[model samples]
Target chain A: MLIELQGIVKDYRLGLEIVHALNGIDIRIDQNEYVAIMGPSGSGKSTLMNLIGCLDTPTEGTYFLNGSNVSHMDDDQLAEIRNREIGFVFQNFNLLPRASALHNVELPLIYNGTPASQRRDLAEEALIKVGLKDRMGHRPNELSGGQRQRVAVARALVNKPSIILADEPTGNLDTRTGDEIMDLFEDLHDGGNTIILVTHEEYIAEHSDRIIRLRDGRVERDESN
Target chain B: MQFRESVFIALDVIRNHKMRSFLTLLGVIIGVMSIIGMQSLIEGFQKNIRHQMEQLGASVFQVQKFPVQFGQQDREKYRNRKDLTWDHARVIEQYCTAVAQVGPEAWQWGIMAKYRDRRTGPANHLAGGVPAFFPNNGYFIEAGRALSDTDIQHNRQVAVIGQDILEKLFPYENPIGEHIIVDGRRYQVIGTLEKSGSAFGESQDNRIVIPLSTFLKFYGQNRSLNITVLAASPELMDTAIEQVIGVLRAVRKVPPGEPNDFEIFSSESLIETFDNMTRAVRIGAIVIVSFALLVAGIGIMNIMLVSIRERKREIGIRMAIGARRRDILFQFLVEAVFLSEIGGILGILAGVGIGQLVALVSPVPASIPVFTIVLGFVFCSLVGLVFGVYPAAKASGLDPIESLRYE
Candidate 1:
């Protein structure tokens, strides 16, 4: 198993109330599986994604990535795990505004202590793979929306992470650009990379082999697409 | 994250916000400018004084009726004291065994010198001294013979002119054997003294030296005399001073337990006095500059905090991509240090320029103190570190999840 979540519970304090964002969620994902998590607003899908991404630790239960329990790890250790094991693509394309595409792609490797020489070659290869070789020198603002998303994708893939976790990757894109990103994800899945995507669109979910639906912070349905 | 990366980012940010960075660096610039500029000027002033003292000779001391006064004093106390005369100089020379030589000198300022048609300005200094006075006061004869004892015995109207007088009165001709008129009196020029540069914007080489007897005859017999006493060697200076003081006290009938009516001053004592007087000035300048630096430090902190706030999303993205809290902290710390160091470097340049500018317009020479340059760099770095901590900590301690959500 590549990922295992056992009875994960997450809580939030909204003023005077204790809101249960995640209520006893259990799931298992194997290597190279393309999975989509789907929910409407207030369904705790984002919270669960955050926990899986190691951006937040679970309040209860355990998370095992590659058979190592990571739920109790400290912040820096979790950051290392995020750097080495998972790559994230956000809906809004959270790229550094002032950095060139190549430099943005090299950020993760920089944090991982990669040498400058090798980091550049790897970033360049990743940009080329994402069909943005010509756009490597362009800053985020200089690129089109589609090209920016492609740079973000190149950043996610440059680390050669075990799982690419994308949150609403096409939320800000036009329909045609959105289709292009979904097609790119299909190519990544075909290349034997494990991919986890969170979205509310059913059509986007259809691109994954399996879909897990959440409602009221609980798993409502789980089935192969 | 690598230190180099953080510095590069900082440079990029500063370049993008040129006006803002300059404004932020203003206080540090002013602070360091004042510190370096003031220190250089003060150092130059001290150097000039020390050089003048060296010209006064190392083993020599002076006896005067009045002390060198800085500010206001009770004039009545000095007024009642009897003037030191050539008789006291003779007694010290004869009775003080430790004294090698005693040269009594008196001065009349604003005396004009006329040679043929060429004449010096009325700001000339006319000094009268014995033959020993020339060597004792570091005024070695550059050309011709110094005043001989025969000149003093006969009260001859012969003068040894300084380089300024020579150049002004006899620019193209040799001043030796020439006659010059001073205050309607004609005196033959015997020799010229070597050039001793000016001190404190007043020319040292604008004087005419005549025999003490001749000066007494023309100026007045009642005028006080300043006696310069040189010890046989530097090691005998203290003993020679004591012997001369004893001789003066005995000859002048000063009571044993009362303070001497005259003052004794040496090069070392003058230097010490100059240091003490300027110590307060140095402290005042430092205090004022420190306040400016403090304000500059505060400005850095303020701008850093604002930068953190503005870059919250960037921080979150970095954290999400695997930057540890320490990496974030290091990044911001380096940024702050970079800002201050740039300000420090610019300040040093400006300060040195200001010091040189003053030197160009005046007699004080600009001497760049290497210690102050190093000190400026260290101080600016410290200010950045001290003031940078709070903002950097805040930046590193930011919750990645929350930060990522920040618009």
Candidate 2:
């Protein structure tokens, strides 16, 4: 197993009351798996994605990434794990507005202490992989919405992590552009890379080979497509 | 992350927000400007004063009836003291073993010099001194001869003029062997002294020197005399001063256990006095500049906080892209330091320009101290680091999930 979550429970303090965001959840994902986590609003899908991406530690549980228990890790340790093993794709296409697409792709390598000459080559390769070779010099504001999302995808792929965790990657795109991004993801999956996607739309989840549906912080269904 | 990467990012952000960055740097600019500009001026003024004191000759001291006054003093006490005379100079020259030479001098200011048809303005000073005055007062004969012992003993009506008198009275012809009238008295010019520059905006080379015997015959015998004494060598200056003081007290009949009723000063003493007088001004300037830097530092903190608030989502994106907390912190700190360093360089340039400008238009000399430049650079960076901490920490401590979701 590349990732294993055992009895994860997350709670939030909303004003004076405690809300259970994730309640006693357990899941397993192996290497090279294409999985989708689906849920309605306020169903803990985003919370689960945060844990899987190492953006947050589990409030109560054991999270094993490559057989290493990361639930007890501190912030700096989790940041290192995120840098080495997990890549994130946000719904809003979170790219640095002032940086070029190539520079944006280079950011991950920069944090991982890659040499400058090698970092540039890797970022260029990642941009070419995302079919943005001609638009590598464009900034986020100068690119179209689909192209911006492509840049975000390139950034996620630059470090060659164990899994790319994308949250509603097409939430802001039109149907045609959204389908184009999904096709790119299909090509990536065919290339034998692990992918975990979080989405609310049934059509979006249908692209994945396995689906786990969550409701009110609990898994309602788990099935292989 | 590499420091170069943080600096490049900082440059990009500053370029993107040109107006905001300039506004944020204004306080630092002004703070550093005042510090360098004021210090340069003060240093120039001090150098000019020291140069003037040095012109009084090396290892030489003087005795006068009144002390050099700073602010307030008892005027009646100084006025009641006996006037120093040539007799005191004679006694010190005879009794003091460490004294090499004694030159007695008396002067009257605002006297006019007339030659043929040319007349100088009524700002010329007339002085009476023996031949020893030339070496003791740092004056060298540029043309012809200075006053001789025979000229003083025989009371000859001869004068050695300064460069200003030579220029004003004898612009077209030689001043040597020509007679000039001063206060209805005629004296033949025997020589001209070298051009000694002015001090504190007053011309030093605008005077006429005559024999002391002739000066006493014409002016009167009641005027006070200033006695100039040169030590045997530079190393003997302290012993020379002590011997002269003892001889003066004995000649003036100063009682035991009582203070001498005269003042003695030297070039070193004058420099020391100037330092003491300007100490308060230096401290006051530093206090004011420090306050300016304090306020400037506060301004930087406020702006850094605002910048962090505006870029919360950007910080979140960086954090999401695998930036550690320390990486984020270092990035913001570098940006702040870059801003202040730029301000420091600009201020130093402006200060040097101002110093040179003042030197150009006035008599005060200007000099740029390398230490001050380095100090300014270090101080500005320190201010940036101190002020940048809170905002950078706030940025790094932000929750990645919440920051990503920030609207």
Candidate 3:
């Protein structure tokens, strides 16, 4: 298993009331798998995504990422894991608006402590992989929505992590551009990369090999496509 | 993250927000400017004073009837004390083993000198002292000759003229063997002195040297005298002074309990007095400068805090990409330091410029010591670090999830 979560619980305090954001969830994901997690507004899907991305620790339970028990790791350890093992693509693109496409892709490598020349080479290769070879010098604001997302995808892929976790990967795109982004994800999955996408849209989940539906912070259904 | 990357990032951000960064730097600029400017002026005064004192000779001290007066507070006490005389000088020279030589000079200022068609005004200084006075003090005879012991013994009417007097009375003619009149007395000029520069805008070279007997003949015999004593070596200056005091006390027959009725002063003592007077002013200026730096540091902190708040999303993105808390903190700290250092450089240039301007227009000398410039950079960097810590920690401690979600 590439990712395994057992008996996870996350609680948030709203005024004096305790709200369960994630309650006793169990999940297992194998390598090279493409999975979609779908839920309504308060279904804890985003919280699950945060956990899988190592952005947050489970309040209670154990998370085994590639057989490493990371649920109770400190912030620096979690940051190391996030850098080396997990890549994140966000709904808003989350690209530094002032940086060029190549530089944006080079961001993870810079934090990875790669030397400057090698960082440039790897970033260029990643950009080329995302079909942005000619647009490497263009800033995010200068690119279209699809091009911006492609740059984000290149940035996420540059580190060669164990898994890619994307939240609302095409929420801001038009349907045609959204489908194009989905097509790119399909190509990434075909290239033997593990991908976990979080979305509320049914059509987006339908393109995945597996879908897990959640309601009110608990799993409602789990099925293969 | 690497240091180079952090600096590049800082430069990029500063360039993006040029106006804001400049405004943030203004306080540091003014603070460092005042520090450098004040230091230059103080250092200049100290240098000039040291030069003047060096010209007066380092291993020599003076014995007078009264202490070196500043604004004349103890007028009655000094006036009532018995005047120091040639007898005391002779006693110091003979009895004080620590003293190398003693030279006594009686002052007769405002003496006009005339040489046929040329003349000098009453502002010329006229001093009556022995030949030992030239060597004991730092005066070196440039041309003809100094007053010999026989000149004083025989009461000869020969004079040694300073460079200013030579220039005034002779102009183009050779002053040696020229006869000059002082208060209707004819005196032959025997030598001309090398030029000595001014101190505190008073010319040092405008003077004439005549025999003590001749001065007494023309100016009178009952006036007070100043005795200059030279120590055998610099290390024995205090010993020499003590020996002179002992001899004078014995010679004057003062009681054991009462203070000696004479004063011993030196160029070093004069320098000390000047330092004491200016110490309070220097401390006050330092306090004011520190307050300005404090305000400047606070301004940097404020701007850094605002910058952190505005860049929460960027911080989040960096954190997600493997940047640890230390990395974020270091980046912000470097940015703050870079800002302050830029201000420091600008302040140093402006301070030096202003110091030079003051030197050009005013009497106080100004010097820009290299150490002060280095100290300015060090101080400004410290300000950045001290004030930068809080904001950097705040940025570093932000929760990655919350920061990512922050608008």
**Model 3 chain B worst lDDT run, 10 consecutive residues:** B65-74
Candidate with better DockQ, 2 vs 3: 2
Instruction: Give candidate 1's TM-score.
Output: 0.96
lDDT: which candidate is best? 1
TM-score of chain A of 2: 0.98
Off by over 4 Å in 3: B44-58, B66-80, B97-100, B106-126, B148-159, B168-170, B177-189, B198-203, B210-223, B231-239, B266-284, B352-368
Model 1 scores a C-alpha lDDT of 0.93
Report how far off residue A95 is in candidate 1 (Å).
0.8
Using all chains and alpha carbons, the TM-scores for the candidates as numbered come to 0.96, 0.95, 0.88
Q: Record all residue pairs in model 2 with backbone atoms less than 3 Å apart, i.e. clashing.
A: none
lDDT of 3 by residue, B1-407 (tens): 67887898889988999999889999888888887888888888888888989888878988887776545667887788888888889999999998888899998778888989788877988899898788776888999999998999999999998988888889889988989998889999999888877766578888899998888878888978899999999999999999999999999889999998988788999899778877888788778888898899999999999999999999999999888899899999999999899999999998898889999898778998679889889989999999999999999999999999888
Residue B24, candidate 3: C-alpha displacement in angstroms: 2.6
RMSD of each: 1.9, 2.0, 3.5
Worst 10 residues of 2 chain B by lDDT: B68-77
Docking class for model 1 is high
Q: What CAPRI grade goes to candidate 2?
A: medium
- Candidate 2 segments exceeding 4 Å error: B46-56, B74-77, B213-223
Q: Sort every candidate by TM-score, greatest first.
A: 1, 2, 3
For model 3, residues A64-89, the per-residue Cα lDDT tens digits are 99999999999999998999998889
